[model samples]
Target: MRVKVEDLYFSYPGKDVLKGINLDLKETDIVCVLGPNGSGKSTLVKCIEGLQPPQSGNIIFDGTNSSKLSRIEIARLIGYVPQSSSQLFSASVFDTVMMGRKPHYSWRCSDDDIDIVADVLEQMGLANLSMNEYNCLSGGQQQRVLIARALAQQPELLLLDEPTSALDIAHQLEVMEIIHNSVHKRGIGVLMVIHDLNLASRYADKIIMMKDGIVFACGAPEEIFTKENIEEVYGVEANIFSHEGILSVIPVRRSDAKLVPESLGIF
Candidate 1:
């Protein structure tokens, strides 16, 4: 599924967040949104998932306007995995994942629904833990379970908010690889809000940098991860390098005093 956001504007009470944001998500693209804290990256994803409505703008998904679709209708098209895994219920892993079929289920779950949920659990490597309590699993395991839930929804578009934030490096790579494979093989469009620049550069087909609720830059990872762009948007100096076909970002730390050298010198 392709998503088009035109003239998007959103604000909370007494505060303006997203400002005239426009973006296009192509099918099978792994697009990552990067920004400093409080830059509205999460808000933009929420708007795309129809969890929060844009104050003024159009969210068109595969040519259908998002506003016209009900929550369940939208869920059928886009599945969201939020940053906080703790928001999940205390249900067993199987039941938690089975909930993803709510949009397709009538009051009762059919045999087909059970088969689909089982398939997703196996695909996500959670089949062995399917009977365990969801909250008792490790952080990475829980994250994968949540993703399995989203996958069982059979959505054409997947919106993830910092999916790898709490995982270790190994788990991060594992989860990202799973997402990459799913996008390539299943043809699902992925839009994720991520904080790690190198991860974004390495995994994302395209990068969108946000600053103060506006898109600062949008392009391929190579085009958007330059030192100048990184310093300007993230307020840090980063050395961007590529090996073979992989891109990497390394941040160079600066002393707080040196960061405002001119002001310090005057003092």
Candidate 2:
């Protein structure tokens, strides 16, 4: 799926969130949105998924306005993995993943749905836990399962928010590798919001650096991950260098006395 976000703006009654955001997501592209907490990363993903409409601007899906697509239509084109979910009951892991197949099936799930779900479970190292209670898993395990579900959807594009926030270093690398391979091998477009600058730098074909609910920079990782950009976006000074053939970032200290606002937490 190809998506164009044009002049997107979102806000609450008292404060603005996304400020005239614009970007392009193309097939076979891995685009990562990078920002501190309160920069509207999550909000931008939600708006793109049409879960919440932008107060202004348009999200065009393959040249069609998001408003013209139904929820089911959107689901067929975009697989969304949110930051977290509040499950009211202990649904089985297999069933949780199967839920992503809803848009593809009508009276009942097809054999393809079952196979896809099973494959994603195996890829995510959760095949053994297919029958386990989802709520009983640890935070990292649950995050993996959520990602598995999104993969099972078999959508053209995947939108993820903080996909590796709960995992240890090993699992984080594993997940990033899986998503990277998914896009490169099959022309699946992925737009993910992540905080780890090095991971984004290494995997993303394009990087979007956001702050104060607006995009401060959009370019390739090497161009967007400059020392000045990091200091401006996160209020921190950092060392940027090439390490072992990979771009590396090491934060040195707070850049200034100005602290990121606590009130922007909800945005």
RMSD of each: 2.9, 3.9
Q: What lDDT score is found at residue 112 in candidate 2?
A: 88
Task: Show model 1 residue runs off by greater than 4 Å.
Answer: 87-89, 254-267
Residue pairs with backbone overlap in model 1: none
- Point out where model 2 deviates above 4 Å: 257-267
* lDDT for each residue of candidate 2 in 1-267, tens digit (9 for 90 to 100): 779999999997898999999998777789999999999999999999998889999999889999899999999998898887758988999999999899899879988889989988988789899999999998777887887888788888999998988788988898898888777766789999999999998999999999989999999988988899999899888999998767889998777634646576522
> Would you estimate the TM-scores of all the predictions?
0.94, 0.92
Best by TM-score: 1
Candidate 1 local lDDT, 107-210, one digit each (tens): 99999999999998998899899999999999999889888999999999989999999999999999999899878878899999998888888899999999
lDDT agreement of model 2 with the native:
0.88
| Full-model lDDT, candidate 1 | 0.90
Q: What lDDT does the true structure give each of the candidates?
A: 0.90, 0.88
